[model samples]
Target: MYVYDEFDRAFLAERVAEFRDQVARRLSGALSEDEFKPLRLMNGVYLQLHAYMLRVAIPYGTLSSDQLRRLAYVARTYDRGYGHFTTRQNIQFNWIKLEDLPDAMAALAEVGVHGIQTSGNCIRNVTTDQWAGATPQEFDDPRIWAEILRQYSTLHPEFTYLPRKFKIAITAAPKDRAATKVHDVGLRLHRNEAGELGFEVLVGGGLGRTPFVGKSVRAFLPARHLLSYIEAIMRVYNQYGRRDNIYKARIKILVHEIGAEAFAKAVEAEWEAIRDGALHLSDEIIADIRSRFLYPDFQPRADQPAALATALEDPAFAAWHRNSVHPHKVPGHAIVTVSLKAIGAPPGDATADQMEVVAALADDFGWREIRVGHEQNLCLPNVAQEDLPAIWRRLEAAGLATPNVNHISDIIACPGLDYCALANARAIPVAQEIAKRFADLERSRTIGRLHVNISGCINACGHHHVGHIGILGVEKNGQEFYQITLGGRADEHAQLGTLLGPAVSYEQVPGLIEDVVDTYIELRAGPDELFIDTVARLGVEPFKERVYAAH
Candidate 1:
């Protein structure tokens, strides 16, 4: 993890002091709720239903062991003894007292973490593929660029109050695990034909009441121009972004209203104006930032191949092999995703003790590195392949071993009624019930790599709009109802889901999901075809016809 510099330190200190004053004023009734709302939000404080929710930025999902320990301390001391990791590679504490928030903020600042840019109309946390540094296919570590953006965007005076909140995600992996297409701005990093690293810039992608998969504004943006290009985009948004209606506030709405070609032209015009500004990334600056991300030492390992062969024999290890593990960049190293979706537990709630265990696992197993994936899972990037069984056993004992990484049961759901004041229904219970319905490993694995996202409301916090099969909870006659949609995805070929049928009762949700899955099982070309691919090829007709079938 990159350590904070004097600049970063000073900025955070000043911002914390500023927020301390804001909190004091709000408490003293000097500022009305409406006035305090935006100010508090800019500082990453939210007035939730039960208590103030504080969302701390975990940039690009990279956390040092020390940072993890501090997070555990926050959970233990201030809030409850746990914290919730969110879908966009951030964490939220649901139980924060206003009185203790200042102390919490100071503690967080001590560890180079903060609530700034975690919420509000400025650019939120710069997220990336959890596997960035350790992945084999990456052109370069996207986290480097993400950090650059973090410094540039945090409390940026110009974009402090944009028309709406902005989000940016970068990924260098061939696989689109970060769902770059569904962000306000998405950067897919890759090397060009000449082997020069660059980015594919997409703008205006987001999901709310309306959803759009952003269009490509620049196909090949060299790394040095990253901040310059981003500045260009932000300037265009600030200048022309709509403030007439909150619903149309997002840049996605702006991108839709103005075609991609015209938007690109506008951004290009702005890019030309400030191409060589102070924000322009120079080689010396890049080298300094890049130095902080130096790879860990790896001793030559002659013992790895045989160890991996030994791991294949254990059934439990084999189960993990088929699920939560991936190939790593190092010779004897393997990528491991520590599944947080254990049965009956919240998807990403790691106990303080468990957090410590993860820290230990990262330290003892490989480099002192850890990654918080966008899918609410943790990634151990360079574990020795030979120790797979032992690691799996330890994770199992710690309740961190659930072999359902990309399988159907590994659903991504929002905190919903459990945490959010904006939610209309309880997504956790519904998700839990659906998990129960598909608990059979054989059945789930047979279905394969399906993303089922559930949102409690149309705000789409759970990203249901991008799931292969999406579920949105709504209130009908004061009763909770769920609307199912099919064919949605957030990869390069991103598309919002189309509704399947009328909203179903909460009681009938599991059955409806079963019907949809069953229909996919019947109509899919083969077991190899995942739900999204099959749905795209076959359309939603089969699933819809079966789900809403007249009995």
Candidate 2:
């Protein structure tokens, strides 16, 4: 968890005050929507279809108990009774009133959270591997560097009003849980042959209208010069990143226009000019940041074979183990996912009550910390196997014990045209509808591993372009339409999804998905065949024949 400094706290408070006045002016008719639009967006407030949508930043996707509770409070008091968690790990309250936004920001500030820099064409929140410290494969905790850079990039004067929004993702782990390749700037931490740690920097990687995996610019950037090195890249981007055309502004476009090697040379020249300056990390700062993120002590113990078998036999615990738990680095301890998806419930929606329960559970069970995943789930990273039964009951009561993690119905979705002005269709209801369609536990489990990513629009906030069954919503004569894609994966083996055929009517989606999944079941080589693998082997022809042949 990133601790807020005095400057950080004061800065949030001041920003809140400024936004409060702006909101007041808008209400008093001194400012019109035209005048207040940019100001509201700067504070992560956007006017949506039916109401105001507030996007709160969960930096590096880490949250404290206090912050979670405050988020819950905001959900209950200012907006609806629940908040929607996004694939990017940020939470959005769908029905906020603009007048209450400043008060909301003030409440978030009290807990060291804010919505600043979450929207608009600026450096957005830095997202990392959800299993940052806990995952075994990680070489170094990327959250440490994410926090360091979060502070450095917050409201940077030089690049706040760029041509379009900017995003950066970092991962120390080799498994690529952060989806590093699909970011504006992707950083992978590795050690050179000489045992010196540095980053393999990739620039100009993003997914939107144009999807391009980031390419390597600097193969090795030493650890100590992280901030300076990143500064150099940003300086290069700030100078050359297109400001003329909104569609062609991201660094990926620049990289494509001039090529990766050319971009690398420019960044190197920029690094030579301003490195080792005020932006560079000092030894003390690095130590301070690193200490804050140090892993908690773990007790070495072997699992009791007899007792373990007994627990796994229990129905509730069996479901949880099957769905929500992962093997911990420590023996006998398991990383538990408190599923935010309940049948008929919104995919990542959690009530304030649920938030408090999760927070208390983190302190009591997970060593006082919680992690928000890119898939919109929360993980308690240090639960002993023994404590899982009690957790299941508590989570069951809180309505967060849904036993779907990466299963067929554990879908990722965006706040579509329902709550986002930029969106073209309604995504939340579709996700909810799909969950309801496959509400049967045995059916979803039988279908096996499937990733269904939904985006309300082509803006691609939902990452629909990269789902095993990707669905993009389009406007057809003013009615909602959806296009499906097969074979997308967001992993070390990252591959973009391919379009199946023409757009399907919105009403035809759930049945279409069911047909595709049913086809996978009928045509599978065995139960071991995943949805993506089946698509890869047989190609889209099989699924497409089943889908569009009837249409």
Candidate 3:
């Protein structure tokens, strides 16, 4: 984790003080709601349908146990007894009082966390593979560049207010766990033929009303010229991106309007003038940033064959071991995902007590570190294999051990009309209904490796565009309805899903989904064939026919 230096501390203190003053003025009637909107947004505060919502950034989704405890404290003291982890790997408190926001910001600052740049048209939190440092297949820790980009983008005067909000994601692994194809700017770190490290830069990828997979603008951008190249891209977008229409304001829209080749040429022309300027990163600075991310001392341990034997005996443990535990680079260790998608609960939400329990478990068994995945699950990245049973027991007792990672029950849903002002229908209840519909562990296992994402609206905050089964909520004739899509994926071979059929009523959503799953099962060649592979093989026509016919 990157520790805050004196400059970092001082900068955050100044931001807090400024926001405090702004809030005081608003309360004193010196500022109207309209006048204070941008100010509150800049600080990651939003007035939602019911109450104020505060989003706190968790850079690269890394947190210390102490930091986790601090978040729990905030949930317990300031708002409701729970917080929602978002698809962006950030957390949102949905019930904050307007007057207590500054105090909340101060509390977060005490633990080296902040909500800066979490909202309002600038680059948001730079995310990477949650298993960055621990994964064996990665070329290097992607967080190295994520941190560098965060530092460079934070409060950059030229980019403080863009035509629209921008997002950047980085990954060094062969797998696209970071969903690189769906970001405003996606950087894939790779080695060239000469064995020199560089980046494969992609631009224009985004999901909203108009979804697009980013195009590769540069086959290879030198590692040293990252900042310069990014600046060039920003300059191009800032100058020509749509400003009159909010829907087309994103860089993705600009890239789509202009050809990718022309966009690439424009960026290259801008880069040529500034590639060797002060923005170029030096080798020394890169090394210094790399040094700050020291890995924990992993002691050699023998594999626990007894735990494997126990898995054979207990079907519950076996299911958990298969789904929750991931392979680790270190011997006799594993990465455990604490599923927030327990049956009938809102996806990605954790109570204050649950947060405290996770913190304690991390301190005791996970080297005092915790990670949040873009899937909205908590990860103990370095748990020893021998300790799996005890950890599973503890998590199960706390209702955190659902063992449904990448399965039908592990849904990803947004706050929707339940909390978000931009939403058309309630998303959380839809997700909860679906989870409850597939509550049988054996049934979910049979369904196998499915991602069901629901977004309340076209904002795509829930990333519905990329799920294997994407459910989008819309309003028709003053009633809530859902439009379904199939075959979307966010992996190495990313593609946007195609619409399945006409919008169905909220009452028909769960049954429609069940029909889709049943169609996949009937058409699949074998049990090993995933829902996505089946969809790809047979296309959406088969599933669409069954869903609509059943309804």
Predicted structure with the largest TM-score when compared to the true one: 3
The residue-by-residue lDDT of candidate 1 on 23-88, one tens digit each, is 899899998989989888887889888999999989989988778888889998999899889987
Which prediction has more favorable TM-score, 1 or 3? Answer: 3
Q: How close is candidate 2 to the true structure, as a TM-score?
A: 0.95
Report clash pairs, candidate 3: none
C-alpha-based local distance difference test score of model 3: 0.92
Range of the 10 consecutive residues with the lowest summed lDDT in candidate 1: 298-307
Off by over 4 Å in 1: 28-32, 302-304
Off by over 4 Å in 3: 305-312
**Model 2 segments more than 4 A misplaced:** 294-297, 300-309
| TM-scores vs. true structure, each candidate | 0.96, 0.95, 0.98
Better candidate number, 2 or 3, judged by TM-score: 3
The pairs that clash in candidate 1 are none
Question: Cα RMSD to native, each candidate?
Answer: 1.7, 1.9, 1.1
Q: For residue 214, give model 3's deviation from the true position in Å.
A: 0.6
Winning candidate number (lDDT): 3
| Whole-structure CA lDDT of model 1 | 0.86
The stretch of ten residues in a row with the least summed lDDT in candidate 2 is 300-309
